[model samples]
Target: MVVTALDLVLAGLVVGFGALVQGAVGFGMALLATPLLALIDPAWVPVPILVPAMVLAIASLLRERGHADWRGVGWAMLGRLPGTFAGVALVVLLSPRAFAAAVGVVVLACVAVSLAPLRVRPTPPLLVTAGLVAGVSGTAAAIGGPPVALLYQSASGPRIRATLAAFFAAGTLLSLAGLGVGGAVTVDGLLHGLLLVPFLAAGFWLSGPARVLIDRGGTRPAVLGLSAAAALLLLGQAVLG
Candidate 1:
């Protein structure tokens, strides 16, 4: 791919905003990236978004040591591994249009589930089930937050944000590995993902100061609004697509 000045500038801006969303709410990279990038080549969306979000998460961790339940994340990842293989296999078998359509519809579904009025704390079965959803969504769309985000309680804001950040990072790493094992992720994917790390870091830098009071309840409306808009955009695209 050509390293045009415009590409860096545009990608930088997108990544910066993505970091702010992630920094502020601890999730939203793919939620923010997908609907926006679908305006360009929808196929170009996932890796770039993941690259920045991963970096943003890394940067967010620098502010304070966000304690992550490594055990929970591991269990979730274990459940997702097989599903990740399934997703990669599905991706390999599907056309770009078909993949995009499926991703859009499923993203909308995750949004609905995350925002459901009847909230239920996840049990062992449910957590593993959510992991499956995370794997499929992450593999298909690089947008996996809604599934596992629902697993965290909003009241426990610190744990919610910290754990979700860890989960997002873990999910991406797992999916990236799956893509490699399945021969879906190419050298270009890895190279591109690494190359975008600077933009991701820059995004995190811009959002650094804002992390001070990120746990406030005020952020929910905006998060949900962006999510709802993304879902609606994805839904429309899926239908018309």
Candidate 2:
């Protein structure tokens, strides 16, 4: 596929903003970027978006490595393995519009759950469950952060960012591998992702200051609001298309 300069600029701006949000909150890059990227170009969904997401995850993890909950990450990874396989299957089976609609539903559901009065703790079992859900969503649609982020909503900002960063860093690799096995990894997708890396770096740099604002009690609202907006946009596009 031939991408024009305009496409690159639009994608860069979307990715940069997504990276900034993810860097500050630890889980919005894919959640915010995937649907928007898909809207820009259907070919950019899972693999291309996953590449920058992986970069952001590694960067966030490095910045807050000491605060991550290793045990929780381990449990999540355990579930991610099987879930990734399922996600790859969906990727192969679904049409682009169908996939977008499905992702929209998942994000909306997650937002509703987060807004509810129920309190969720990141116990071993729940972490595994979140990981499983994340694997499927992240692999298929690249919007896997909400499930895990909800579990850590009440935790300190640094811990939430660090732990999620660790989970995504490994989980994204697993998803990419699954996509490769499923024959969903394309050279065009990779090149597009590489083109967006500099934008991601700029976003990550800006996030250093943004993190302070998030830490001052803006995390949950930001997560929920951005998620809902993206989900709505995705669903609208699917229906209209």
Which candidate leads the pack in TM-score? 2
The per-residue C-alpha lDDT of model 2 at residue 206 equals: 95
What is the per-residue lDDT of model 1 for residues 122-171, given as tens digits with 9 covering 90 to 100?
Answer: 45666677788678768866767766665564435556566677767767
lDDT of 2: 0.84
Instruction: State in Å the error of residue 34, model 2.
Output: 2.0
lDDT, residue 167, model 2? 94
Tens-place lDDT digits, model 2, residues 21-129:
8888877777667667777887777788888888889999999999999998999888889989988887778775787687778778877887888876888898888
RMSD of each: 2.9, 2.1
